[model samples]
Target: MKLIFLGPPGAGKGTIASRISKDLNIPHISTGDLFRKAIKNQTELGKKVQQIIESGDLVPDALTVALVKERLNNPDVENGYILDGFPRTIKQADSLESFSKIDNVINFVISDEQVIQRLSGRRMCKNCGEGYHIENMKPQKEGICDKCGEELIIRPDDTPEAIKNRLAVYYESTAPLIDYYKEKGLLLDIDGAQEVGKVAEATSKAISK
Candidate 1:
């Protein structure tokens, strides 16, 4: 079924979306992944996107919408697709509605404080890009990668101020979608504080019902 997964940074929406997409045999259509793939492939759209990004400007909504439409038309999407990181604004939601209505919108809820801890403590491996956290999930050695001897580094985006800014921007544009979909009775809010499996179970129940 067509679904939208919405949540703040470090909420594990991407992880849950990937798992759900596999279990339901649907394409996991994430805009972030889409952009990365397109850029890596050097497609026409990618060239345009790369130019915009190089200029330090946000990719225009129209281009993003067009790219999504192209992906949706793929043969693999015949059954449905799970949307992650799309519809960042009400305008994008409107554009999506013009194409197709969403069956369910799953929102993972967590506090701001929790979000900071989850993101800020994240450490990335210097060698293989494996990630670990100071808490919840730690490495075999402090400040060192288990698989590789390279020291782990905190990603720039993991800073508290950056995360707070991201949360503010998300709430400003995305918080409204919760109400918009709730009015249509298609919204499912789940506690993101739970384990990933538990969250996935709740999401599956919502999608099934």
Candidate 2:
């Protein structure tokens, strides 16, 4: 399908993409995972990425584009792949268009208030790193991990202020890609406020056409 999934954090792009990838037998390619894999493997690009990340600087777009270009060369992507987090800017989108034909860009739409509420409610287990939500997926006991009986703590980045900051950054950088793809007639909007199952169903129906 050569798809791109776009949405703010907590919009369930990753979860829905995973489901759609399995249903269609296509790989779900996330740029974040690519960076981690590259760094873990200690590739040449990985070395540069590690240095950049260690210095706490955002990775430059050129390097990011190169990494995506390299990944697209892999054979598994021959059939198709769902790109979860790439082309975060118009320049990156242009770079992608230069190398590949994207079939669709699914833009999951949710309000900032909903995003903040969803993210701020997230809790992670201290011991096993399992995830839970205060509202959506509560554990058997309050503030505890069901699997490991560990204390569940709110992630620092999941705080309301932090989520608002992230949304600001997203609006500044990635949000324009929505309009960019829409102009190209390749954008599909999906309501992200729905239940995960319903969202997945809507996404599947959107792509199936």
Q: For model 2, what is the error of residue 116's alpha carbon versus the real structure, in angstroms, after optimal superposition?
A: 0.9
- Output the worst ten-in-a-row residue range by lDDT, candidate 2: 155-164
lDDT of each: 0.89, 0.94
User: What are the runs in model 2 whose C-alpha is more than 4 Å off?
Assistant: none
Model 1, range 99-194, lDDT digits (tens) per residue?
987889999998888888899999999789998989878999999999988999988888888888899988998889889888989889999989
Per-model TM against the reference: 0.97, 0.98
User: Model 2 over residues 1-209: C-alpha lDDT tens digits?
Assistant: 89999999999999999999999988999989999999999999999999999999998888999999999999998889999888898899999999999999999999988998899999999999999999999999999899999899989899888888999999999999999999999999999999999999999999889
lDDT of 2: 0.94
lDDT of 1 at 135: 89
Worst 10 residues of 1 by lDDT: 155-164
